[model samples]
Target: MSQVFEGYERQYCELSAILTKKCNSATILDGEQKKQKLSEIKAGLDDAEALIRKMDLEARSLPPNVKATLLAKLREYKSDLNNLKTEVKRITSGNVNQAARDELLESGMADANMVSADQRQRLMMSTERLNRSSDRIRDSRKTMLETEDLGVSILQDLHQQRQSLLHAHDTLHGVDDNISRSKKILTTMSRRMSRNKWIIGTIIVVLVLAILLVLYFKLAH
Candidate 1:
């Protein structure tokens, strides 16, 4: 149960981050920015879907009541993501348009719609779905907190695991950095050594020539 909850927690955090990133990315009016955000949202959705499957499996193993609650939460999350997808589709398709473009806009049907009625209805739907999903996720989290045994021992164990993972990651990063620095240093040293060798060879050749010249002069005299 704890393991399943852990996975769900990670998924929830990822989804939240993706939502925040999408919102931030959407702030940029550029098409590139929008595309990037869209891609991120897709990836996030994929991760969420995978997590949902895992949760489903774990839920099957849980007590009937817990399983039912989790299943309900999962369904709500699925619905929410679906809604968001629809809204996003509408946005990409440019379903929203000027009032002059459609009579529905003047009739208030379009006005009631998100952003613009001319904008793809899919996109608007997606937005609504995401909002609902977020809400449900929050509710689910609260329920889990209240129902689950989130004692100090469990929390401390999780903290230790997190710390270990973080430390490992940092250590790997440090090693990579060290290796990069070492390579740079080695390259510099190799270049310097080559220069030094060239200089020494040149000096030796000059000395040899000088000695030969002196011998020749002495022999000639």
Candidate 2:
């Protein structure tokens, strides 16, 4: 049980650190990159929430204060997740506007007579904004991919460590079983030796009694 709690604590700390990094990464991003990061963040939050649920179930045996603290952290994490989702929705709406503008330009509907000077200026600005957004998204994606690769490597290392621990545990159990079997064999041998000693002592006493009886009979005669 202690081991379980310890494992949970370690996982929770790792998750918290990852979330903090992700949040920081999001702050440096904007437009589509921020939106994409938010999506990933939402997924991470889901995983975190699942862990919290597992912890909650297991923590029934823990101190009340400890359990309460865990619950509070979970709630806080959830609130942050909600805020991120809201941001995603806002970005999505902006993307829709950008898409509509692109569609109009592609369809040749943005003619000189149809759009005024002010409207053209606004369209140019939107186009430039989108171009910049795309560039940032590209850079952010590269960084995110690198971070993901690092995370995968860490997980693999952890998996290898877990396998090693399991192997060690199995080896220990095998040794324990061998020790138990040896103890049982020694107990059986000791019992057999004691039985043989008791039988030999009884035979000697019977032989002495028989000899004394014969001497008495011979003397009486």
Candidate 3:
């Protein structure tokens, strides 16, 4: 009896998880992902329904709390399924409306060749509407041309400004290069000056040593 109740509890949990997953997937996924998720949801629902029926057969033996919980979960699952159905219907209906609109337009085009007076009237009205639309388009195109001319002028000004900026950047870079070269030249000159000072001091020391040696030799002689 305990094992039977545990099995029912596990099945209820599985159904609950499936319902939660289905609701989340429907809300978040779209296109092919949505379709795939919906299929999985349906499969889950089928499995849950089967499990519920099996549990129902043993309902008299089940504890009151377990039975109540199962009923509540089933109700919630039914509500979610209804909501999903409504969403699917809404999406499909919108597509149907669009398709109907397209078919109406196509039919109107075909009616232009029909011999009926009513059809001719509709054709005339459609033609007139098209002509008016063409006129408006022509006016819009003229306005667009004027706007384009203004845009071209603005673009030219922007191009000139960009060129000026580029020239300034180049000039600044040249100045930086010149400063760097000057620093290198000054460093080389300072190093040469230090070497020259060292050479001059060595020469002075050698000449002094030679003079002292000559004085000593002359005294000894």
RMSD of each: 30.9, 23.5, 26.4
Residues 47-141 of candidate 2: C-alpha lDDT, one tens digit per residue? 76776567667656666644554454445444544554564454445444556455544652434223333433553454356446556766887
Tell me how far candidate 3 lies from the true structure as C-alpha RMSD in angstroms.
26.4
- Judged by TM-score, which candidate is best? 1
lDDT of 1 by residue, 97-186 (tens): 554234543443334343333333543454356546656866987888876666766898999999999999999999999999999999
- Candidate 3 clashing pairs? none
| TM-scores of all predicted structures | 0.39, 0.37, 0.33
- On the 0 to 100 scale, the lDDT of residue 61 in model 2 is 65
TM-score of 1: 0.39
- Runs in model 2 deviating more than 4 A are 1-131, 210-221
User: What stretches of model 3 exceed 4 Å from their correct place?
Assistant: 1-147
Candidate 1's C-alpha runs over 4 A off are 1-3, 20-28, 97-221
Q: Report the number of backbone clashes for model 3.
A: 0
Deviation from truth (RMSD, Å), model 1: 30.9
**Number of the top candidate by lDDT?**
1
